[model samples]
Target: MNGSGKDDKQRNRVIAKNEAERQTTGDIRVSAWTIVFAIIVGAIAVYIVWAWLHR
Candidate 1:
């Protein structure tokens, strides 16, 4: 009974660690995408402004 309990605890720990890692990776992916989107939008805005001013 004691050995079974220890095994359960170990399994739970592994699952929890996996979940935390997945969450962290998801957050990083979202942040990276946001940064990419911001850069693209900024470039477009600059281009529009330049074209308007020059023309």
Candidate 2:
């Protein structure tokens, strides 16, 4: 409403560029316990499906 279409496009481009830069520089940190828990849950799910199919 306040600005023109070109201004909106430029603002959107700047926002997208910043987001891209942040993602590239970001570090993903996952804890060991989280990984272990996920694996345990996945194994349980697989076991349940296997038991269901066999029985």
Candidate 3:
């Protein structure tokens, strides 16, 4: 058999690995942003409730 088959498999494996790493890093950034927004919203909610109760 020609060696072309092994080379194709190796190329496919590398492509898949790179895609996986890209997706993982993308998810991490999204998760960080989500956490930041969640904290901000929670703080705003607490402020609103405190102001409502005191006023």
Model 2, TM vs. native: 0.45
**Best by TM-score, which number?**
3
Q: Compose the digit string of candidate 2's lDDT tens values, residues 1-55.
A: 5579889999999999999887765533345567788999999999999999999
Write candidate 3's Cα lDDT for 1-55 as tens digits: 5799999999999999999999999999999999999999999999999999999
Candidate 1 vs 2: which has more lDDT:
1
Q: The CA-based lDDT of model 3 is what?
A: 0.98
Model 1 segments more than 4 A misplaced: none
The CA lDDT at 7 in model 3 is: 95
Predicted model with the maximum lDDT: 1
Query: lDDT per prediction?
Result: 0.99, 0.84, 0.98
Q: Where in model 3 is the C-alpha error above 4 Å? A: none
- In candidate 2 the C-alpha lDDT for residue 53 amounts to 100
Per-prediction TM-score to the true structure, in the order listed:
0.85, 0.45, 0.93
